[model samples]
Target: MTDPGRPFPRHLRQALRTIAARVYLAVCAALLVWALVVTTTDSSDDSMAGVIPLLATAPVSLVLLVLPDHAAALVVAVVLGALVNAAVIGWCARALRR
Candidate 1:
């Protein structure tokens, strides 16, 4: 039988999970912004280093890892991630055609 005084582990686990989810969300947001910057910058420069794809996919991926049951978060992240990736690719392609 679980002891009445043994709530610490459960509380600790939840706290850790919440912190992880927040961190993942923050990172994803940053990556999305970085992808936009990469797209706008000069194509001749190597600042992006071909990481746009990874940035595009990181939102949903990291959110899922942090909050598996958060379907809403997953959907939002996926949609946003897709849009970010699309924007980056579109800009890059346009830069190339110039």
Candidate 2:
């Protein structure tokens, strides 16, 4: 069993508190909102409404293409991609802080 001291390491916590990390998170939040709006409002087959979010999300966003076509799946994919991006940003900020 692992020690139950801190749930997260010191550096990671610090990184998450940094300005760059916060900005990234904010941008991700906006993107998520945009994606949700596009997904829910645009029903046309050639809407092209998801392009911005999909491109902004990149590699993780690719999951949307492979998953079964459904609104829930799209939401899940975007949320997952945003989470992964937040983690990456936090790690990068932590590394650069050292």
Candidate 3:
């Protein structure tokens, strides 16, 4: 059982405990890291590697596109987007199992 005093609700806590949630978050992390490495090492401006990660995280971070282009912005978008996506996807998976 979940503790009532915990910040996360029971459903969310349960969702995060599942394997699906971890996989989703892992994918996001991998993409984000790949994007960063490609951007830093590749001279090509049209590299799809960097863009792909942003696209993957676009569901939640799309709004962040309006923010000025900066390292901080990208980091925030990727991190937060990954987290939100994982939580939602995990929650849905848990719900489906019920």
Q: Per-residue lDDT for 47-97 in model 2, tens only? A: 665666666666797866688987666666776776667667877877777
lDDT for model 2? 0.69
Across 18-95, the per-residue lDDT of candidate 1 in tens digits comes to 433445446656765665566567576556522543444665445544545543544455546654444444445444
Task: Enumerate residue pairs that collide in model 2.
Answer: none
Best by lDDT: 3
Instruction: Please identify which of the two predictions, 2 or 3, would achieve the higher lDDT against the true structure.
Output: 3
C-alpha lDDT (0 to 100) for residue 60 of candidate 3: 77
The number of the candidate with the highest TM-score is: 3
Clashing pairs in 1: none
lDDT of 3 by residue, 1-98 (tens): 55678656666767777798898778888988888898888887876675676777777787776678886788788778877887888879987998
Ranking by TM-score: 3, 2, 1
Q: Judged by lDDT relative to the true structure, which candidate is superior, 1 or 3?
A: 3
TM-score of each: 0.35, 0.69, 0.80
- Sort every candidate by lDDT, greatest first: 3, 2, 1
